[model samples]
Target: MELVFATHNRNKFKEIEAMLPDHISLLSLDDIGCTEDIAETADTIDGNAILKAEYVRHRYGYNCFADDTGLEVDALAGAPGVYSARYAGDQKDDKANVAKLLEQLKDKESRKAHFKTVIALNLKNNENLFTGICEGKIIEERRGEKGFGYDPVFVPNGYDRTFAEMEMKEKAEISHRGKAFKALIDYLSK
Candidate 1:
C-alpha cells in the first residue's frame, strides 16, 4: 500500500519510514509536493495529528497519516505539552528549548516525565488514531549523541541511558515514537 506521511521534518520521515513494511511505498510531504507550512494550533497530540493528516488528505485527495508527539514534564505540570515543538520560541531552536527545560527543572527533585505520541490515519473511507507513551525520567545533563529532539535527556523506564545513547535499532524498539508507530502498524496489519 501507498502512504503519505504528513510531515516536513526529515527526521520524522526517517523514523516512521524505518518501521513500515517494505511493501509500503511511503512518501514525505516534499515528495508529494506539500511544501506549504500549516499552523499547529491544536491543544493536544490527537488533535494535531488528525489536523495534519486530514489537511494532507484533503489537500491531495489521498490517504495520508500524520503524527504529533509531546514531552510532558510532571514538574512543570505538563508544560511544553502541545507546544513541545516551539516551546522555546517560534524559531524552535533545539538547544534553546533544551536549555529552557533544564533551567525549569534545575531545583526540582522530582525528575519525572513521559513522552507521548498520537498517530492519525486518514483513509479514504475512514479515519483512525493510535496513541502510545513511554514512561521515563528526565536527566539533569544531556547524554549521548544519537537520536533527535529531547532524546539526550530522556531515558526510558527500564534503561539507564537516554534515547540518544542507544543505537537506532535499539531506540526504535523502545522509543515512544516506536511504540506509537508499532501500535499503528499492528492496527494496520490486522
Candidate 2:
C-alpha cells in the first residue's frame, strides 16, 4: 500500500521510513508535492498531528500520517509542550531551544522531563491517533553528536547516554516517536 508521511523534515521521514515493513510504500511530503508548511496552530501535540494529517488528506487526497513531538519538562510546569519546535524562537533553532531550556532550569533541582509523540493517521476516511512517551531528564550539557532537536541533552531513564549517543536503529527502538510509529505500523499491518 502507498501512504504519505506528512512532514518536511528529511531526518524524521527517514527515521520512520526505516521502521516500516517492506510491503508498505512510504512517501514523504516532498514526494507528494506538499512544499508549503502546514500551520501547526493547535494547542496540543495530538491536535497539531491531526491538523497536519487532515491538511494533506483533504488537499492532496492521500492517505497520510503526521506526527508532532514535544519535550515537556516537569520544572517548567509542562511548558514547551506544544511549542517544542519553536521553544526558543520562531526560527525553531535546536541549539537555542536547548540553551534556553538549560538556562531556565539552572536554579532548579529537578531536571525531570519526558518526550511525547503523537501520530495522527488518516486512512480510508478514518482517523486514528497513537501516542508514545519516553520518561527522561535533561542533562546540564549536551552529550552525543547523533539525533536531532533536544536529543543531545535529554537522557532516557535508566540510560546514561542521551538519544544523540545512540545509533539510529537503537534510538528507534526506545524513542517516543519510535514507539508511536511502531503502533502505527502494527495498525497498518493488520
Candidate 3:
C-alpha cells in the first residue's frame, strides 16, 4: 500500500517511514514532486493534520496522511500546543523552539508536560483521525543530542532519560507519534 505522507520535513518522513511496516510504502512530498509548502493555518493540531492531508489529497489526488505534534505544558496552560513547530518563529528552528520552551518553564516547579500527536489520513475521500500522547516532565536544561524538537528537555514518564538520550528504537517504542502511527496501522489493517 503506497500512501503519501504530507510533509516536507525530512526528519518526520524518516521517523514515520521507519515505523511503518515493510508492506506499506511511504512517500513524502518531495517524493511526489510536491515542492509546495502545505500551509497549516488551523487553530488546533487535529485541524492542522487534517488540513495537510486534505491539501495533498485535493491537489494530487492521492491517499495521504499528515501528522501534527504539540508539546503541551501544564505550567503554561498548554501554551505552544498548536504552535510547536513555529514556537520560536516561522522558520521552525528546533533549537530556538526548545530555547523558548525552556525560558518559559524556568522558575516553575510543576514542569508537567506531554507530547501529543494527531494524524489525519485521507483515503478515498474518507478522512480518519488518530491521536496519541506521551506524558512526562520538562527538565531544567537540555540533556542529550539524539532526537529533535524539544527532545532534549522532555523526560517521558517512568523513564530517567530524555527522548534525545534514548536510541531511535527506544524512542519509537514510547513516542506519541509512534503510538499514533501504530493506531493508524491498526486501522488500516482492519
Candidate 4:
C-alpha cells in the first residue's frame, strides 16, 4: 500500500502526498539510496514522466510514479512545452523562466494558455498514465505572492486572481496537479 513519487521536488511531493489516502504511503528519491540527477530531455510530458517512473521503479523495484508538467500557450504555439522549467536557459530558476515568458509575450495579444500535467505510474507488474490540463491566460504583470512556478502570472479560467493569490487548499481544488491527481486516484480505484 505504499508508492514512491519519483521526483526531487519536496513541494510537489507534499502536494501529492496531501491528496493520497492513508493506505498509500508516498516516498521519494531521498527515501531510496538514490541521488543521481537524471536529465528530463524528453520532448513531451508523457515521455518525461515515463522516463522518471520507469527509472525509479527499475532501480528501486517499487510501485512508483512521476509527474511532468508544461505550460502551453496558443499564441506562442507552445514555445516552452518541454523546456518550461529551463525556458530562460541552463539555470532552472523559476523567476528567470517567468521573466523570459513575460518578455516574449510582452507585445503579443493572444495570452491564452493552458497548464498540462502528466503522471506516469509504474507498478512492479503494471503501468498507467494520466493527463490533466487547466486552462488559463498569462497576464502582463505578476500578481499575488503565494504558490510557486507560473502561479503568479497565470490566472485560471473564470477567475480574476492568479494561482498565487489563492490559498493552498483553493489551488488544490482547481489546479492542473489537482485535476491530474484526481484522475489518477480514480484510475487506481478501478
Candidate 5:
C-alpha cells in the first residue's frame, strides 16, 4: 500500500520511513506534488494533525497522515505547547525557539517538560488519531549535533543525554514521534 506522510521535513520522513514495513511504501508531500505549505492554524496538536491530514486527503485524494508535536514545559504553564514550531517567531527557526525557551526558563527551578506527538491518519475516508509523549526536562544548554527542533537541549526521562545526543535508532525507541508511529504502524499492519 502507498501512503503519503504529509510533511516537507526530510528528516522526519526518513525517521518514520525507516520504521515502516517492506510492504508499505511511503511518500512525502513533495512526492505527491504538494509544494504548498499546509497552514497549521489549529489551537491544539490534535486539531493541527487532523487539519493537515484531512487537507491532503480532500485536496489531493490520497491516503495520508500528518503529525503535530509540541514541547510543553510545566514551569511555563504548558506554554509553547501548540505554538512550539513558531514559538520564537513565524520563521520557525529551531535555534531561535530553543534559545527563547531557555531564556524563559533561566530563572525557574522546575525544568520539567514533555514532548507530545499526535498523528492523524486519513485512510479510505476514515480518520484515526494516535498520540505519544516523552517526559523529560529541558537542559540549560544545547548538547548534541543530531536530531532537530528542541532535541539538543531536551533530554528524555531516565537519560543523561538529550535526544540530539542519541543515534536515530536509539532516539526513535524512546521518542514521542516514535511511539506515535509505532501505534500507527501497528494499526496499518492490521
Candidate 6:
C-alpha cells in the first residue's frame, strides 16, 4: 500500500520510513511535491497531528498520516507540551530548547518527564488517532550523539543511556513514536 507521510522534516521522515514494514510504500511530503509548510496552529498533539494529516489527505487526495510529539516534564507542569518544537523560541533551535529545559530543571530534585506521540491517520474510508507514551526522566545534562530533539536529555525507564546514546534501532524499539507507529502498522496490517 502507498501512503503519504505528512512531514517536512527529513529526519522524522527517514526515521519513520525505517520503521515501516516492507509491504508498505511510504512517501514523504517532499516526495509527493507538497513543499508548502502545513501550519500547526493546534493547541494539542491530537489536533496538530490531525491537522497535518487532513491537509495532505484533502489537498492531495491521498491516504496520509501525520504525527506530533511532545516532551512533557512533570517538574515544569507539562510545560513545552504543545510548544515542544519551539520551546526556546520561534527559531526552533534544538540546542537552545535543550538549554532552556536544563536551566529550568537545574537545582530541582524532581526530574520526572515523559515523551508522548500522537499519530493521525487519514484513509480513504476512515480516520483515526493513535497515541503512545514513554515514561522517563530528564537528565542533568545532554549525552551521546545520535537521535534528535530532546533525545540527549531523556533517559527512558530501566535504561542507563539516553535515546541519543543508543543506536537508531535501539531507540526505535522503545521510542514513543515507535510505539505509535507500531500501532498504526498493526492497524493497517489487519
TM-score of each: 0.97, 0.99, 0.98, 0.96, 0.99, 0.98
Q: What is the lDDT for 112 in model 5?
A: 99
TM-score winner, 1 or 2 = 2
Using lDDT, give the best candidate's number.
5
Reference-based TM-score, model 2? 0.99
lDDT of 4: 0.88
Question: What digit string (tens of lDDT, one per residue) describes model 4 on residues 101-158?
Answer: 9999988999999999999989875888888899999998889998888899999999
Better of 3 and 5 by TM-score: 5
Least accurate stretch of 10 residues (summed lDDT) in model 1? 37-46
Query: For candidate 3, what is the TM-score?
Result: 0.98
TM-score of 1: 0.97
Q: State the lDDT at 40 in candidate 3.
A: 88
Q: 110-190 in candidate 6: lDDT tens per residue?
A: 999999999999998389999999999999999999988999999999999999999888888999999999999999999
Which 10-residue span in candidate 2 carries the lowest summed lDDT? Answer: 10-19
**Residue 85 displacement in candidate 6 (angstroms):** 0.4
Mind giving the per-residue lDDT tens digits that candidate 3 earns over 55-111? 999999999999999999999999889999899999999999999999998888899
Summing lDDT over every window of 10 consecutive residues in candidate 3, give the lowest-scoring window.
8-17
- Sort the predicted structures by TM-score, highest score first: 5, 2, 3, 6, 1, 4
Query: RMSD to native for every prediction?
Result: 0.9, 0.6, 0.8, 1.0, 0.5, 0.8
Off by over 4 Å in 2: none
lDDT (0-100) at residue 31 of candidate 3?
89
Which residue pairs show collisions in model 5? Answer: none
lDDT of each: 0.88, 0.95, 0.94, 0.88, 0.97, 0.93
